[model samples]
Target: MPVVLSLNVAQKTAPADHARVGATGIDKRPVDGPLRVSPPGAKGTAGSGVAGDSIADWNAHGGDYQAVYGYAREDLDWWQSELGTELGAGQFGENLTTQGIDHTNALVGEHWRIGTALLEVTGPRIPCRTFAEFLGQRGWVKRFTQAARPGAYFRVLEEGLVGPGDEITVVHRPGHDVTVELFFRAVTTEAALLPRLLAAGDSVPPEVVELVHRRSAVELDS
Candidate 1:
């Protein structure tokens, strides 16, 4: 059964490097207490859904659509081996470092019940310059994208408190086969896979749905 291996919250601090703005919360640390979570409105106006956690880049991170981040421990382990480095919980800036679930391949729109909260898998966590800088790796963004193992992002549907060791129950899964990996592939390296993302309907990002429709129209015209 899937479980929350660790619950991490960001410890906001001044820019860790020149790659970021005034401050950044990319270096999340594991927390033992229950965390309050809720919808954080939108991207620019919000910080983080997990109360006490911080978000420095209002333009790029945090919002109702990405209220939570879940990365599988298995993937982190893989990265540790591939990068030859020691990575701990929250290394990837994930709120919930999970175990026992194929989190990276989780289908978009799947609902999960962890603790007293209900969350829906919304999209794939895109690798950003901050992430690359935080990892201190060269071409890290390209490498991460190539792996196609980007962790899944979530939106809290029913707000509540959650903590580490909580069992993650997948309450529902959309019928479509739009896994996080597929979503990443469609939006990034493989443009040809975009059409298949249409099958996900509204489960994916609104911009993605609109892009698919626009592309479909262009193809029809051609």
Candidate 2:
């Protein structure tokens, strides 16, 4: 049984990364007690939950498909060793820091029941310029890409409260071979794998499915 090691929310602050020119809510910090969890709503709409946790970039973040993000403590440990620094929970801007779960390997559409909320894995967190700037590491984006240990993003299925130490149980897993790592690879570096994403059915994000079909069509035409 996986568990939430810490529940975190973003701190509204001036843009610390090149990804945004205005305020960015990427500097997440651990919160005490239970935190409300729900859909961030559709794009162009404000994200739900705590007031300050709102998505700073509507064009690239937020929406029902990416309501919450999770990162594994194991992966953070790995990065700590590489960077020779200590990383607290939520350093990666994840809402939940989890323990004892293979986050990168979890299958898309896998459901995790935490507290009273049900969340389904949507996809992997792709590193962006903002994340690179947040860490202040040169070539961080390329390094992160090469590592390919992207954490997972989930969509809220049942709105409820979640807090640290909540037990995480996999209540459902869609029958599919498309793990988060595989999907990340398909999106980032493996064009051939795009066609294979169809095996995951609707488990894949609608936009991702459309992108896969578009890429597949272009390949066929060429």
The estimated TM-scores of all candidates read 0.93, 0.94
In model 2, the clashing pairs are none
Candidate No. with top TM-score: 2
lDDT of 1 by residue, 1-222 (tens): 889999998867557564457578888999996988899987678978998888888777888878899899999999999999999999999999999998767888899999999999988988988898888999998999999899988988999999998999999988888888988988888878998887776667676788888988999999
Enumerate clash totals for all models, in the order shown: 0, 0
Candidate 1 RMSD to the real structure:
1.7
Instruction: Report, for every candidate in turn, its global Cα lDDT versus the true structure.
Output: 0.87, 0.84
lDDT, candidate 1, residue 26? 83
Q: Give the TM-score of candidate 2.
A: 0.94
Model 2 C-alpha lDDT per residue in residues 1-222, reported as the tens digit of each score: 689999888766555537665656778899885887887777456553433475678667777877888999999999999999999999998889999999898999899999889998989988888888888889988898889899998888888889999999999988778899999998998878888888877667788899988987898899
